[model samples]
Structures are given as C-alpha cells and as structure tokens.
Target: MQNKNIIITGTSRGIGYEMALQFANAGYNVLAISRKTPQILIEHENITCLPIDISDENQLQQVNEFISKTLKKVDVLIHNAGSLLHKNFTEITTQEFQNIYKVNVFAVAELTKICIPFMEKGSHVVTISSMGGIQGSMKFAGLSAYSSSKGAVITLSELLAEEYKENGIAFNVLALGSVNTEMLQEAFPGYEAPLSAKEMADYIYNFALTGNKYYNGKVLQVSSTTP
Candidate 1:
C-alpha cells in the first residue's frame, strides 16, 4: 500500500471522510473530492483535497486536470459520493428525481470513464450503494427516487466489471444498510443505526484494498440490520 494512489469522492464528512483519512494514514496518496474542501484532510501530508461538484460536467473536468498533473496512475477509485431524495412517489417531480440520479448514477459512470485511462489491471472501482437498492432485500416508502438511483448504479457496476475484465480492472458495489449518517438522519429521524460511519469506513477500507482480488462485478450487502 505504500505510495499507492487513491481517489475518493464525498469526503466532506461521514464514511467518506474516514476513508480519506484511513488511506492517507496508510501512506497512500489520497485525492479527496467534495463540494466543500475538507478541512481535516487538507492539512494531511498525504492528502490533496479537491472541492468540486461531481454532478457538474465542467467541475468534473477539473478532476481530470488534477490527475494528469499529480499522479502517474490510479490504484483505487472509490465512488463514495451519493445523493438521497426522501419524498413520496406522488410528490416527486421529474427534476427532483433527475437530481438524485445525476449524483448517484450518472456521476459514477462519468467519473469512472475519466479514471479508466489511469487505471491498470489491478485497479479497483468501489461504488457505495444502499441495501434498499437490492431488488428483493427490502423496500421502504419515500425512497422511490433514492433507492432506484442506487439500484441503477448496482447494475452499472456489474456491466463495468464485465467490460473492463479484459483490462483486469475490477468494479464492485457495496450495498450498505442503515448507518448513522447525516443523510440517514434526514430520512429517518431519531432512528438509531447499528453501524457507525467510522466502523463502516474501516470495513470498506480493507475491502477496497483486497476485495477485488476475490470479487469482481459483485454486490456485497454490508448490512447486519434491516432498514
């Protein structure tokens, strides 16, 4: 893991923040991207924080420029950024749904495309998804847009894995259960989650490092509780 380079999105806080810290602490060069620059990460010697809206095409080009000048290759790319819309299907507008999909699904695909040229055979692309995205696992009300967007990404990962298999690049999704995140609090008020952000980040950290060796084009349900 020494001198390895990793690019992670959604690092303003929660699991994404922890991932940036974990990877940088392990001597890996970390490029942490978020809408707002993460204060804690900017001071780290191994971390370079980029503030950009992943959903915006113009801002996404900045990621390409950064990589072109900064790193030789990308060893790991984790699409940890997500957008959640907690609204009833009846109340959801087309624009509202598009916003969620833009962040969750479209951004993942576009960003992966940008990073592909930098990725080699052993590189891994880990996308963070929701358990609610799984077809038969369980369903929740007021998550039509959010859950559906997550589901789209799951399938996207599967196809990317197959398409990139010949290149030796791996694509996988982690469908997570309830976690005590700011986004979760907004959707389910006062609902205590069994897992903490740091704990989940710990699991994902190890998984991103080694899961690709055993699994590719697979969705691992990292949930111990029902939503």
Candidate 2:
C-alpha cells in the first residue's frame, strides 16, 4: 500500500481515525475527511485531513477535484462514515428515518459514484457495515433504523461489485460485530468491551491490501471468531 492515494471518510475518531493512521503508517497517502480536523493528522506528511461532511455532495465534489488534481489515481476508497438512530421503529419519525438513510446509505452511494471514475483496475473499495445488518437480535430494543441502513450498505457494495467487475475494481463490505468504539458504546452502554478500533483497522487494512482475490463482493464478518 506504500505511496498509494486513499480517501477515508469519518476520520475524526474511532474506527475511521484508526484506519487512517494504519494506512499512513504503511506509507500510503491518506486523504482523511471528517467534520473536524483530527490532531494526529495535522502534521503528518502522508496524511491530509479535510473537514468534510459526506452527506454534502458539493463538498464531495470539491474533494473529488482536489484529489484528481493532486493524485493521478485513487488506489482505494474506504467509506467508513455512518450514523445510528437507537430508537424503535414505532418511535422513529419519518424525518429521523430519512436522516439515517441519508448518512449511511445515500452518502455512501454518492461518494462511491464520484470516486469510481478516478479509480483504476486493482483499486479497492471497502465499506464499514455492522453484524446487526446480517442478523436481527433481541439484545437491542431500538436499532431498527440503524440496522436497516447498514443492510442497505451491504447491498450497495454487492451491487457495485457486480457492476464494476468488468473494470476490475473490487468492492467489499466489512461487517463488524460490536467494537469498542464511541458509537458502539452509545448504542450499547452496558455491553463489555469488544474488539479494539486498532484491531479492526488492522484487519480491514490487511483485507483491503491482500484479500482482494478471495473476498471481493463478500461480507467479511469481523467478530470474536475473526483473528
């Protein structure tokens, strides 16, 4: 991954921040986007932190232009930003549902669409999904909106993989179980500490770099069973 240009969303904290550090440490040029600039990325030679909200298509277009001018090709694009609404289906308003969909599903699709043109064969796209997307459970009482949005993200990755297969672009979704991130803590306060963000980042970075052949279009679940 050395010297490759990669764009990672949601890098202010948690999994996204960890992923940015991992990629930068591997000598990859990282364009880290978040609502606020992260301190760790301020002075890094290999990292460029941009304050961007993925839901804003205009801002993403600006980002697209900046990247296209700075780098010849975008080697990887990681859609790691998402939102969660921990409310039951009956309690959620239509606007709330739309808000979650806007961030988790719509933003992902839009960003991918804009970035795909600058990508070449052997490029990889990774989306951060959740295990809640695959199976429903009784542990969470108010996760309908969050879970549904994640399910859409998985489907989006699958469809993109098929559509771009002829172009040799690989797309994969990393469906993580509970991880010890701020979002997980907010969603499940009483749960024990799960996988560390760094651990998950390592797995994701490795998969993006080396697992392309066997894992494309597949939802690789990262849980207790995952190494």
Candidate 3:
C-alpha cells in the first residue's frame, strides 16, 4: 500500500489526526496537512506533515506545489479541515462567515482541484460534513455559519461525483454526528458524544479505501441519535 497516497487535512488533532495514524499504520503514504504540526504525526516514517492554513491563499498554493512534487498519484483525498463560528445568525460578521466557508467549503474545493490532476482512476474524495447541515434535521441556534458551510460541502461533493465520474473518480460526503473532539467541545461545551474520534476515524478510513465501490454522490449521515 506504499504506492497508495492519501491526503488528509486538519490532521493536527481529532478525527483527522486519528485517520492519519490509521492510514500510516496501514502502510499508505499519508500526507497530513494542518495549521500546525501535531507532535504524534511528526515521528511517523510513512506520514509527511505539512503545516498549512487552508484558509490562506498563499499557503494553499504551497500545498499544491508540495503535494505535486511529493506524490505521483493520489488514491484518496479527505477534506476534514473545518471551521465553526458559534454565534447567533444575526451576529455573524461577513468576514467570519467567509472564514468559515474558506475552510469548510472553499479550501476543500481549491485543494481538490489542485489534487485532481494527480488523482487517477479509482481515486476517491471523501468530504466531512455535519449532520447540522442536512435538511430535515433538527436545526440548532448559533450554528448558522458552520451549518451553511457544511451544506455547501454536501452539494459540492454531489456535483463533483457527477462531473468526475468519467474519470472513475468518486466523491462522497459523510454528514458526521457530534464527535468527541476539541471542535465539538468548543462548539458545544460540556456535551458528551456517543462517538469517539478514533471510532469515527476508523469508519472514515475504511470508507475512504473502498467506499467508491459501494457509493457515489451520497450524503450519509452518521449519528448515534437524531438530534
């Protein structure tokens, strides 16, 4: 599996970080990107850490160059980096909204665009969204910006699945439930999640490897409860 290259973003911690460890242990060359290098991932021989803030245009360009030079082909691309602004809908500033979208949607799109040339047939793109973004779910207050950005990710993945089907590339979205992560703690203080980061990482890793064979243009909500 050393020949297989997987790029995972927001790997400084949480689900993304756990996914990097799982992929590295499975012998895949893991390209881990985040705003800062996580201490655990730095010592892995199969993991390459890129300290990149995806919201920054300049840093994103650097990521494009670095990955292009380092890997000949991309087998899987996981867009897990995200931003959440817990504020009332009326209080969200334009810049804050943009920042949230930058990481949750725009960065995913830009990075995927750059990585597509390196992705051959059978490559899979898995985007991480949130249950809050899906329609018909119980909506919550103070999540307007974050939820909307995730909603865009769902549609974007669907569109990409159609546009790139000819190339044998598949796109899918995982509308994740609340997981035990720093992001979750920050967004919902003192709340406990049924799913741990490692558990979610395990599920995502397996899906990333073989999900295209079973699914395409699908938004699968993964939650323990119907919040």
Candidate 4:
C-alpha cells in the first residue's frame, strides 16, 4: 500500500477529497486530479494535486505525462469526477446534456485509455456512478441528463472489464445512492442523505484495493435509501 500508485479524479471536494486524503494517510502515492486543487491535499506529501478540467481530451496529456514520469505503473484508477444538471428534461439545452456526458462518461473513457498502459496485473479500475444509473431504480425528474450519463458509464465499465479481463486488469462500477455531496445538494436541496462523503469514500478505498479478487464487470449499488 505504501508503494502503490493510485489515481483518483474529482478530488476538489466531497467524496473525492476524502478518498484522496484517506489514501494519502494510508501511505500510498495518490495522484489527485480535479479542475481546482484542494488545499487539504497540499499538506500531504504523498498526495500530488493536479488541477485540470478532465472533460477536455487535450488536457489529459498532462496526466499521461505525470504517470509516465512519476509513476510508471498505476495500481488503481478511480473515475470519480462527474457533472450534474438538475434542470427539467425539456429545459436542458443540447450543450448542457453533452457537457454532463463529457465529464461523466467521455472523460472516464479517455482517462482509462491513457491509464491502461500503466496498469499491470491485479490492477483495478473503479468507476463512481449514481443510483440513477441503475435500471428500475427510483428515478428523479430533473436528472434525465445526469442519470442517463451515469448509466452510460456503467455499460462502459462492463465492456471494458470484458476487454481487459484477459490482461489481468479488472473494471467495476459502483452505482451509489444519495450522499452528502455538493452535487447532491444542487440536485436535490434540503434533502438529507443516509451516508456522508467520508463514509462512502472509505468503502470505495477498501474496494479498489481488494474487491477485484472477487468482483469484475459488476455493478454494486451502494445505497441504503430509495432516493
């Protein structure tokens, strides 16, 4: 754990921030990426804060370079960055919908492609999805764009798991329920969540390291509530 290289995006705040902090505290090398670098990570020597808009494919070259120079191999890659649009279905513009997918879906694929070469056998790729992505889950009205984008990534993870299974790499998606995240607040104001960001990040931290041995190409719905 002390020597492993973990790349986790969306570390500016919320669950991503906690995940980065926890991994750093555990003595692992954490490459934390987000549009804005979180100050909390600045204090941790093991954590490398990379502030970049991951939605842009062009900006991903920085990550590629970082991995090539800093860490040749990636032990874990967690796609935790996401975009949320809480407007009604009809009110959402085409660009807004595409922007959501750009962060939640396209960036996941683009970043994974760049990290695959640095992954070795026993490496794991964990994608952070939403409960809305699950089929038959309680659907929200203003989340058409966000929910569908989440679901798209779920399928993407499944396919990647199969494609990379022979290479000894594993891919899995966690469709999480409501969590006390700023994005959640934007999506549903005044709604209390059953879990906190730290709690869920802890679960994901453990899962990324050990879950591959038992699960791959699987979607784990990590939720305790309907909403």
- lDDT score for candidate 1 against the true structure: 0.93
Question: 142-222, model 4: which lDDT tens digit per residue?
Answer: 889999999999999999999999999999999998899998887779988989999999999999999999999999999
List candidate 2 segments past 4 Å from native: 135-139, 225-227
**What TM-score does structure 2 among the candidates reach?**
0.93
Residue 222 of model 1, lDDT score:
95
Residue pair clashes in candidate 1: none
lDDT comparison, 1 vs 3, better candidate: 1
Candidate 3 structure quality by residue, lDDT tens digits, 45-89 = 999998979988788887678766778788999999989889998
For model 2, give the 10-residue run with minimal summed lDDT: 132-141
Model 4, 139: alpha-carbon shift in Å? 0.6
- As a whole number from 0 to 100, the lDDT of residue 103 in candidate 1 is 95
Error of 2 at 210 (Å): 1.3
lDDT of 2 by residue, 1-227 (tens): 57788889889888889989888988999999888877878678889888978787788787878777887688898888989888777989999998888889998998888888888989999998887787553235688888888999999899989999999999999888777888877877877666788888888888878777776798877778432
**TM-score, structure 3 vs. true:** 0.98
| Model 3 stretches astray by more than 4 angstroms | none
Prediction 4 TM-score vs. true: 0.98
The number of clashing residue pairs in model 3 is: 0
